[model samples]
Target chain A: MTVLDQGLTPPAPDLIPDPAVLDLSAARRDVDATLAGFLDAKEQSAPGPELPPLIALLRRFLDGGKRLRPVLCVCGWHAAGGDGDPAAVTDAAAGLELFQAFALIHDDVMDASDTRRGQPSAHRALATAYTANGGQSDRAEEHGLGAAVLLGDLALVWSDELLHRAGLNVGRLEQVLPLLDEMRSEVVYGQYLDLQTTGRLSDDVDTALRVARYKTAKYTVERPLHIGAALAGASPGILAACSEFALPLGEAFQLRDDLLGVFGDPRQTGKPVLDDLRSGKATVLMALAVQRASRGELRKLRAVFGSPDVDEQDATAVRKILDRTGARQTVDEMIRTRREQAMAALDHVPFPAAAVTALRTIAESATARQA
Target chain B: MTVLDQGLTPPAPDLIPDPAVLDLSAARRDVDATLAGFLDAKEQSAPGPELPPLIALLRRFLDGGKRLRPVLCVCGWHAAGGDGDPAAVTDAAAGLELFQAFALIHDDVMDASDTRRGQPSAHRALATAYTANGGQSDRAEEHGLGAAVLLGDLALVWSDELLHRAGLNVGRLEQVLPLLDEMRSEVVYGQYLDLQTTGRLSDDVDTALRVARYKTAKYTVERPLHIGAALAGASPGILAACSEFALPLGEAFQLRDDLLGVFGDPRQTGKPVLDDLRSGKATVLMALAVQRASRGELRKLRAVFGSPDVDEQDATAVRKILDRTGARQTVDEMIRTRREQAMAALDHVPFPAAAVTALRTIAESATARQA
Candidate 1:
């Protein structure tokens, strides 16, 4: 039986409590410290100089992040009335950060994105490093790509090591492992859908939503919350409550991102406005536009949507079609609906007051942020 | 403390003893069955139709393998005198297979290899699948790489799941987790080294040997043995003995593979002979040839080596240079020396008689095989 099933809860297995119920900003700092300490240990223990370069890259890549998932994880722990010992929850949060790093590094390579967080993407940085190290010019890019893949892999395995080190007892372990497993499979399946759909403009709104749900809704939100709850040895009712709140909020978060990818200022978003359209990112917004487009607009979209050489003028033309077809407005309405639904979920459960406030703040920022 | 450190061993926590002392052939079947069952469960529980194609691809890819790692894992268990149920150990063996699959899939993508085991490599096959699925031709190859990376990742996580599900008790888990963690780091570091060295045509024998040791000897041979021994909660002395025997034998195994990769018959080896040379795989044999080559020969070597267009004539020229420089003969002697050292290690330890025989047979086959 799980910790919740027993008449009495178990004591801390190893780690004693760290300071708990910190506000979001404080929680971010703790997550960062845990990540830094873990990676510092890894670098110190690494056998050769060769690994330092990769480690350095990972540290740099991790420097810029919202830390939303990690913050949510800690909040979830609190929401479940998890008393004492936030250390393991902190480690789990750090692990979520590492997992995100792995996903982004690989995603950049897959998309051939040159920049991330306003710096060179992992592959780009590695390629520059290759050339700086006097590698053959012709082979540098391929070498960079290969190295990035390996680096991503290293990040992934290390994340698991962190999770394993969380000092959870058997009961807690049984609760967490399957949730972690499902998170991994879901994100990968989501990526698979994204890759297959990219470079092809389609009117399949269902697939587009499925992509959003798998990629963002569950992986980015629900799993982190669920993992934190599991770390607390939460009951099934608590986990189900997390899903209800997380799924709609996560979807709204992704919808906001899809909008920002196209319409938001690059200075705030840190990505070119044309990137999503140029890459033909499969999104509900695009699918809706495709569904409603006239023949002339459809032809225009076909010409510009996946074009590598697409100019601002071309993007403007596509944007006009989306506006004209009411697709953008519809997506805006969808976001509102999801945001309201997620807010309703929060009221249905009587979580800690602090956790409720944190969740509300997170939901508002996620749906309303410029970036 | 570990199971061995305790005054007396505890009973099996979950899995009861399966039959033990079976030869490698019988062990292979058990490992295969475990993997099949695990994967079958994954397929059934997967949420949608989208995952089935990827699952099918993985099942097909797994259909071909030597099962050497898994078999050695079982052998290590017996050698360590691990008594009682072999079920957990078998699950661990199966986990090793999935890990190997993960490694090979990503390696193929990194190397951009066209084939593996006489079939289209994972990326190539995945690309074919993408095109077959009505994906645009321009994006199909990229889709395949992304999918393969994801597929490899799934295999990796699933391997961890299998290991977790092995039903080993706390003592076994404590003993096993670190070894597993180290094995992962070592192999990735090895791959990183391999990527840096490939296509450079360096005469750095030390670096080349380091690559071989890290990439092959330790990862392919020693770790599997170590993990198996750990599963049995092997005493430190037995674990040390495993390393002594494994390292030299593993090095020899790699040396033999280096030779066969360039010289073995394609029909037997299931790989085109030109592959290793064309990829400029950093092997001690190549390093030795570079070190000893005349100016004229070095120029010819540079022109033909690492060339995608390298033909049989080019390979013949390289072979002639290798022979004339005494590189091939020197490698053969090195293999002989290492093999002898490994054989001598067997004499120092009083391993189970059956295990010693199995280890000897594996050593002979690994070092002497034509393919």
Candidate 2:
């Protein structure tokens, strides 16, 4: 029941109007156009036919996913009063997206995820294609897996390639490099903690929370935003304030996601019910539930928590235990509190009113949405 | 028998030195000292005790491995008539070694190598430690594998970190960056070809050789030398000549390695008899053997090749087939011819007499050694 094990698969009953529909600067719109063109250009530069399958895998993996991180980066740059050309901004944003692509590909393989963003995961997709094609059936699975793994490595290498070629200012790049390094290092360490934390429910709550912060919260929001802000030459004081706002916001975001993973409606979440429960995620909410459960509840939870064969009846029993023990309410309250804390942090930072308002709206919607 | 597959392992007895008593230049010696200091300095900077285990793994994995790449870099700088402070050269050399570290770590994981430099591979070593330390037996293997994977990523990131902090001339770094990218991209693509070539022993010989050249020949020796030469601002013509010299020598080095993997003395190679046969490596010799084998010989090879459970009898049969088909002698002749071609290329380059002599000596020793 560690924070890392907390619910993340939230369900959205219906799609909401774009929270980012607030009037964007002309520069921002131009940046978006530029990004679209850049991605198109990358596709046109595919090495050869031998590489088409890999490129397709990337294209499919990237489809229909929210470009939230890149959007945040653009917003952060704007909020910091940076005035780069649209091309520059777009290049930076695309670099961020490529980095995200790399991270997601590796993370999927690491998690053994069968799907991502409502489609077959990259490895599975490649495997499917391999079999459908003329490849040998006996070795096709291994070949596809190998290809997917290498594709992830290629993406990571290409991320740096994109950044190196982006023609950004040296002063700015030097400043941003360490921040990016820290982001990478912390996230990896956070993942290490996460995989190591299973069944260690009685560990310190603060330790679990810190792990969650590094693994999900910072990587998801803070670092991406900081990258943009750093490029803008934001002072340390200002960057610190943004991190303060981002930390709580990111934590709330993950907490909400965790809640959705288990308790959210399937239609809203684009997922089946109790995915995290079935996966045996060691989340904060689960920890809280385990901590406060009655002896009988604890015994039942221990019996079925990680069982691959847990039936619908067992899932219902676990859900009942979650509700009866008041952990659900506790987690819900925590999410609300964190969201409020994020807003409070923002109050101390000076930002353009429109961007600030947009960020606030995003915070509220992110935490409160059904998904 | 892809070119990339040729250098999949260490060079044969005739390509490498004793793996001991190799002469070290002042620059290389200085770089080694700096690396020791840097490793110590880095230990104090990590977030927790987690680094110790990782560092230990790296130390074990790196120990006894020849710093040939780094040495090549330093020698190249010298050959190009560059005269810089010893400390700076060492820092730059460290950069090269760090990159090598990244390469080796990732390569081991990709190859599923059980041992490196006669010790348990990093992943297996970590997994062994995890089990011995009372970690969950079920996940001990996974933990080790994941840790090693992440460790490789860390080495890559930190390799850049080292270069960034090396305080080398910005102009020099710019000159080197594109070359570095090419080196990395070519190596990865070569790996792709090598992996894709498995069981393709009867495929085109030229394609296999091409893969081998890119994967092993270029990356192992050519690029490291180029990095040094580029930093020294060598003329394009001079660099071109260096490449001509390096390419074939590198190829010969790998060809020798393939021979050792299959037929060299087991004690010296530190591997079992027919190791490559069991592992199913698609080497130049294997491809050649397949091409020249009679129908009966081909059947025997098909039965033994890539079989994890290949027995001594199967190994003897396969060896007999390779010998009978004259493939072993052909490969040996190929290695000799490539070595001669490498020396001939050096004749066209107008380097200083001392440099020419030193490089020639290295090439001669590198290509003519046994174990």
The digit string of per-residue lDDT tens for model 2 on B90-165 reads 5666776766676666666656677766678777887888778676687677667666666776666666655545
Report DockQ per prediction, comma-separated: 0.56, 0.37
What does candidate 1's lDDT look like per residue over A1-371, in tens digits?
00000011111223224333345566678889999998889889877778888999999999976677787788788888775767888888889889888988888888888887778989999999998998888888899999999999998888877776763442476778788888988888888788778888989998888888988889888999999888887889999999999999988888888887787887877678888888888789999999999999999999988889999999889889989999999999999999999999999876776677668767887787776
DockQ of 2: 0.37
Scored by TM-score, the top model is 1
Candidate RMSDs in order: 7.7, 4.9
Q: Runs in model 2 with CA error above 4 Å?
A: A1-49, A129-138, A167-171, B1-31, B86-89, B167-171, B233-238, B350-358
For model 1 chain B, the run of ten residues with the poorest summed lDDT = B1-10
Model 1 sits at a Cα RMSD from the real structure of: 7.7
User: Where is the poorest 10-residue window by lDDT in model 2 chain A?
Assistant: A1-10
> How well is each residue in A1-371 modelled by candidate 2, as lDDT tens digits?
12222222222323224443333334345545554565566567644345656666776665544556666676677667666364444566666666667666656665567777777877678778777766567666666656666677667666665555543443465667677667777766676666555433432456557666877788777887787777777788768877888999888877777777677777767666655665566777778888888999988888776555777788789888879988788878888899889999878787666557667766776687675
